[model samples]
Structure formats: structure tokens, C-alpha cells
Target chain A: MSFPITLTVNGSAREILLDDPRVTLLDLLRERLDLTGSKKGCDRGQCGACTVLVDGRRVNSCLALAVSLDGAEVVTIEGLASGGELHPVQAAFLAHDGFQCGFCTPGQIMSAVGLLREGHAGDDPERVREGMSGNLCRCGAYQGITEAVLAAQGATARREDAA
Target chain B: MNRFEYVRAGSVAEAVAAGAAPGAAYLAAGTNLLDLMKGGLATPATLVDVTRIPGLSAIESLPDGSTRIGALVRNSDLAHDPGFAARYPAVAEALLAGASAQLRNAATTAGNLMQRTRCPYFYDPASACNKREAGAGCAAIGGATRLHAVLGFSASCIAVHPSDLCVPLAALGAEVEIEGPAGSRTVSLTAFHRLPGDAPERDTVLEPGELIVAVRLPPEAAGFAAHARYLKVRERTSYAFALVSAAAMLRLDGGRIAEARLALGGLALKPWRAEAAERLLAGRAPDAAAFREAAEAALEGARPSGEATAFKIELARRIAVRALERALAGTPERVPALPASPFSAPLANPLPSSGAIAHA
Candidate 1:
């Protein structure tokens, strides 16, 4: 029972052979691919610490099995920036002070990026708050997070989700 | 999580063949199954990956004017579908009201339908739960009876179905299409889920290898689109399970009630469809008094399972009244800033919240 899969991570193709079928996308990204930017807060789907974009949609990486996404495209926190310039969302997070302890920064940023791509929340702070409700900030930084998302949407909509 | 074999079924036939085997489960987006595995509650030996199964992700409009939603279609996609939301507003509202955005993006239609109860005892393996272990004592019987069922609960289980989408679907008379190792069949969504009677472990009537292929809405379901709403009463303002919810849809003719469909969540082992209430409100006017009578009829046989939910009986009746009133007010032009919360959508005449009754 050999499991060989190919996935495009951050526009780079990777061919990997799995020794264990139980490996989740979270485990694969961190342990096998050396992408540790995505944190493992709960190792379950409850917390958004393991959030990542799979095939252009945000999902809980911990809940996704590696073998199930054989030909999928994945984007994690490590792949958000290009060269040295920060993505609009990361820059907005910095400008808006969206993080206090910065533990949930990566997952929060990824979720915000997904939210912008979905384009459900415009400049409305209320919609932004409800859209980002999945990512919990234990440090009570929701106001700034919502602000960052609202600001980032305007900036990213011009660039058409460049990240 | 325990180690298990993974098989990506290429087609429905392959999925049915492998999924029919003992100790094998179907894996779609892995939102619920993986969570259950992490909690040590589910331990399937093999997972038949069905995410990539061909033709299981399309939302098609049938020639019969009914809508067919594929089992693998993501929850977010179904809610955001322009044609679907226009026809079934309450279902969309219920979907948007449930789970966080990320979970909805990964969760699928069938996965949502097959969701397990959120009862604390069911998740806590150390606690005795008849749903988790057959013949085991019910730990939630006397403990944490606040969110337990007020209707269709038995001594074996008091756990309520934790699905917001099911409430609207059941009210709209949706049907579930299933494919097993033997053949294909269909059953109404209302009868799909089994109540906890002598056997609490069996959540649904599916045989071991049956796979839910698609859920089809009847042509008549669209009739309630204009006067339908899903109102969820959660502990918090957003992203929380409902304490009590109601899906109220009405068809009015010349200021008189033509027909009414009411289903409730967080009140029973399944979405409690109130046909008796509908019968009471068939010819009556869509006024407060008629709504009150229908609400009372909806709760005709309801009794608190324990002291924790004693006030919830009154609250459930109030929610039924409130949801009916919202539906009669006409479906909102756009989904409110919040999906199903009563507070989010300003009502024409908000039933003074029968909210949060304190129990000592």
C-alpha cells in the first residue's frame, strides 16, 4: 500500500511518498516539508491555528489528510510573502497591530487572506468580524484583526489578491 | 490519532464496494471525521477517500424544477449559490449561521447531514454515554441537562442534534439519495435520522456501506422562499451552537395562512418538524394570536427532561413564535450581518426575548 502524491505548494511542485497514511496536511507541512510557520494550537479543527489555503480555499490543515490531496495546490503562511516585500495583508497586520503575542499571527493572516479572496466582507467591520470569527485571538486582539481585514481588503482588491 | 489505511475511491461504485467493508469509513473533507478521531470517539480501520470522486460536487437544477445538491459540495458554496439561496433562503441562512467560515469551507453537505451530536458526554470518552458505548449509562441524564433535548428524547439519550442546516432542510421536505453496495435508494431527510429510543448508537438508518450521493429538494420547497427564516438562539452572538432554533416558513393567501412548515433544532434528537402546529395554522391568519396557538401546538407534548431545561420549554415556545413572526414579515432582501441570530436581524415585532433562563 504505497501512497505517492504530488502537490503544488507555493507554486512549487513537490512529489512525496508517504510512509503513514494517517499523516495530515498539518503534519506533512511541518514535519516533511519544513513549513513550520503554521502553528499547531489544538491539532484539531476547533482552533484556527492550523488554517491554510487548499486549492484557493481556506481550510483547517489538521483536519485534511495528506493522501486525500494528491493533486491539490496548498499555500501556507511561509508562502505568503514574495522576495522581501510583505503581502498586503501582512503589511496591513503590521500597520494595524493585529497581533499581541504573535502566536496566532500566521493562521490569522492566512484566514484574513482567504476572507479577502472570498470577497464577502466589504469595508463593513461587522461583516469582517463575522467572517473572521473562525480565527480566535486569545489575546483579545479582535478589534485590530477586524480593522486589519477591513483595511487589507481595500488594498488587496486593487491588486486582485496578489498573495 | 490512530493510524489507519486510506483508499481514494475513484468512483461511487468503488466507494460503495470498499465503504461496505467492516471498519471502513468514507472521508470527504475530513472536517468532522478527523475531529472525532482526534477525540478518540471514532476509530475506523480504513478511510475511503471520497473527496475526489467524480461528479459528486455539482449543484444541478433538475428538469422537474427541483434542486439537487451533491453530497461533496462544500457548505460555503451551497449557501453562497445565487440560484439556490434565492429559492431556499432559510437553508442558506441556516448554513451561514453554522460553524466558522473555515469549517464551512471544508465541510460538505453529506458530512453536515451525518454530523454527530455535540453532547459533552459523547465527546468525553471517559464519561458513560449510550451514544458512544452501547448499553453504557447516560452521563448527561442528570449532568449538564441544559442543552439536552426537550422533545423526542428517551432515557437512553438526551443528546440533541447539533445541526443548524438540518432544521431548514427538514422543514423544506428535502430527500436524501443513497447508494449502497446493493443498489440506490432515497428517503426523506426527516426520516433519515433515527431518534434515540432503545438504541442511541445508531444515529441514522443507513446500512453499514450506504453512501449519501446527493440531497434533492422538492419543487414545492421553493414555495416558502418568500416567507421563510431560520432563527438560531445561541449562547453567544456569533459562531456558537443554538440553545434552541426554529425554521419557520409560511405561504399566505389573501392575508390568510395557506400552509405553514415549522421545524426546530437544539430541541430534539432530530430536527423536530411541527406538522401538528402547521395543521393548527393552516386557515388562520398570520397574526400574533395564531402564531401563539401554533407555537403552543408545536410544544404540545414537550416536557423538560430535567431541571436545567425547564425554562427552555418556555424559551422554545417563544422561539417558535419569534421565528414564525419573522417569516411572516417576509424574507430579508439580504442575509443580515449575522446569519440566524434574532438580535442580528431587526424584527418587525421582536418577541421580547425569552432568552437565557437561569437554572439553579
Candidate 2:
């Protein structure tokens, strides 16, 4: 039996129905909502391709069931753009050459944004690598990805100073 | 995944009631359970969602100078907790060592303890795994078992319980507080996870419909001239499973050992406590010879299964010695004292883009 589930996604109230209690949020986003930005890499928790934000916290959607997300707030890569302009993290990815095949970019960006919001981005490169180790890219674009997150941290800091 | 009835439990009592029902399982963080269900390793007929139940997510200090971690507390939250770092550094380090940031955010304290093994045969439906089936012959006995067990293994099953948290839990004499349909009970961490003796199918001593409420950490007196460390030797630098790992907490007195607690991971079906090695360390001063002897004592009875795993015994010993040495040299990080930070930090470098990557 599919139950009626209402949650906040991208700042909008959304209703989703799920039959199997095991149906993951990754499936609902990719299949039901057609929000293909969140990629499913391993389906297992090994890969971070399906990373998303639940109540401003980064989570692996592939391991999260849709029914468990009732009344929770969700954010996907699709919501990264504001007023048709890319978020600072996305812009930093472009500047830092943070991706190649880009399959893991969505998850990487989502994770990076949350990292910055949490204020873990400092000058240390090792810290950056450890924080971003969750998302894996077969293209071996790790160097660029790390650089992008660091760059985003600087930009966010500058914007905060200006404000 | 098969269809299963679902109910959002309002309280711990309700969740236990639902879980006690035949084929019912509690759903806290779906990081492990959902994946296992999709892989067809577990097919529960009912799921009791317990995340909605209040008071199941707090990581608070108890009156007894111990800490009580709620069952629904996320691994990431626990890892970053400042108090956890100060008191139970090994527990936090173990959490940080397992899984990625994203998975850690979703994996709960109870779910991570209840996670199944990563054995390939256990996930393969066609493979004859005694863990997967009650009476099937064990294929891992002769199959590719480079990642299989080296101790506490039986002919029935050879799969290792793959939780880094359990290692420290065993060494620190942690206890599990659980609520069930029958009543509430507490089980010591060492006795909670059982070995795959004859019944390889049972991973934990938990009864059906029993909900893990909290994990209690006993208070430890400060000033162990000895230090502690968690040494994980894995296939990769990060995000890889440990081939053979060691968690050791040594208390040094006058450059000699006052007390020692050691546990092994990735080599046994359950958390392998090195009682033999621990006995050798007590009252003896910490030194190279003492550490080596302790390591050897820990591995003496370990029966290695495969040709490649023969090295794990030695590897585990080396890690134990090294970890003890490090612990003796300096203070080991217990758990973090602060609450979990919501921000994500930069981990690695940005991927090189043809169009130039943007800097933050």
C-alpha cells in the first residue's frame, strides 16, 4: 500500500506516494519526480552519488527510504540554482575544474555546500580531502573537486564580509 | 524490494511492540537495512519507523559520569560530538573510520550495530551461504575468502561483523540498553554480538522485536600514562574496508603497563577481544618486548582460514603493537566534546575542468 507522504523539497511542499517501505528517496527523486540530478552509483552506501540534503544535513539518499522522510525538508542538486544563477558552490566547481564525466558532481557539490555551511572549510588541504572522501568519482577528478570546495569557502567568506 | 507494511512509531514501546510481531524490524536510519533489503539479504514483512519517536536521538551525559547515546543518534553526530571525543575517543574514531560522510549522516547507532556483513556470497542469492539460508552449505569456506574471518569462525559461517564502533565498545566494557515486547534488559557489549558457531544466521543476541534504546559508556579514571589508538590497515587510503584492524587501549605506569584492553576487527565473526594479550600486559611495564609478546599472545589461538589471511594474524599483531606504542606516547582522542557540526568541509581537490573550475 502506498501511503501519502508530504515533505518540503526545494522550498516547496511536495507530496509523494510510496508502496514498498524499502523504496529509497533516491528512487523517488530519480524515478517518480524525474529529478535525475541525484545519480545512483552503487545503490549501496559505498558510493556517494546519491547525496542530498535533509534538513540542511548531507545524507546518502540511496540508503534512505521515502517513507522515513515524512515531514522532512529535502534539497537536491536541482535546487542549487537560485533565480537561474548557480549557487556559489556550483560556480566554484566550474572555476576549480572540479569535474570531468560529472556523474558524481551533484553529490560532490551538495556535500561541499553542506561542508561550507558547517564551516569546516579551512586552509588545510588534508582536512578538505577527509571531509570530501564520501563522494567518489571514477573519472579521478578528486584534485579539482577538492580545489573547488576550498575556493567556494573563500568566496562564501568574502561574500559574508561584504554583507 | 518486496512490499512491506510500514508504521511510524510514536514511542519506543510502540516500536518494540511492532518489532515483536513476526517479521517486523525497526527502521531508524535506513543506511544498512534498506540496502540489505534491496540486495535481497533481508525481506522483513513489516517495518516500524522509529525516527519520529521523541527522545531517541539525544546524545546526553548520564549522572554516573557515563554517556548514553540514543539509538537513533546518527553516526556522524556521534563522531563529531566533543564529549564523545574526550571520553570515548576510540568510539568516535571508529565511527569516523567507517563509511563516508554522506552514509555516516544517515546511519544510526542502532542500525550500524545491526548492519550485516559485506560478504559477497551473503549478498549473492545463488550462493550457498549458511548466513543467507539456515541449512545451506557454506561456499565461503573454500571460495574467495581473502576478506573472510581469521578467528572465531566455524564451518557453518565465516563472515565478519563489519562495524568499527563495536571494537572499542567491546574494549571499554560498554553495555546495550534494549526494550522489547517482553520487557527491558541490558546486555554487555561483548555478549551482545555472537559468533557464527553452529547457527551462523544469528548475528546478535537480540530477540525478535527488541529495540536497542541506548548504549552506555562507563566512566574511566584519567591519567593512564598509557595511550590508545585504532589502527586500520585497509586496501585503500580511505573509504576502504579494513583487511585486519586493531583497537588497543593501554594504561602505562612508570613506562610499564598498568592495564591493557585490545580488540581485533576484520578478522573475526564477532568483536575479538585479545584476553590473552591483555593478561600479558597487566602489571608489566610497556616496552617493545612486552608489546610484541602481547601481540603474539593475541594471535596465538587465531586460526587463519586462507593463504592470504595467514598474514592478517601478523598484521593484526603489528597494528596492536604500533597502536599501544602510540597510546603510550601520547593521549588518544576519545570522542569529540562538541555537538555535530552541520557544515561540510572541503575534503579533496576540485576536478580539473576544461573550462577552469570555480574557486569559492
Instruction: Identify the candidate with maximal TM-score.
Output: 1
TM-score result, candidate 2 = 0.92
Summarize candidate 1's per-residue lDDT along B1-360 as a digit string, tens digits. Answer: 787888889999999999999999999988889999988899999899998889989999999989999999999999999999999999999999999999999999999989999998899989999999999989999897998988999999999999999999999999999999879999999999999998999999999899999999999999999999999888887888999999999999998999999999999889889999999999898877888888899888889887898877888888888889889889998888888887774665544442322221
Q: Model 1 — TM-score against the truth?
A: 0.97
Per-residue lDDT of model 2, residues A53-111, tens digit only: 99999989988888889889999999989998999999989998999999999999999
Please tell me how candidate 2 rates in CAPRI terms: medium
DockQ each candidate and list the results. 0.84, 0.53
Cα lDDT of model 1 overall?
A: 0.90
Q: What are the TM-scores, per candidate, against the unseen true structure?
A: 0.97, 0.92
The list of candidate 1 runs beyond 4 A from truth reads A158-163, B349-360
* DockQ, prediction 1: 0.84
**On a 0 to 100 scale, what is the lDDT of residue B339 in model 2?**
11
Off by over 4 Å in 2: A161-163, B221-226, B332-360
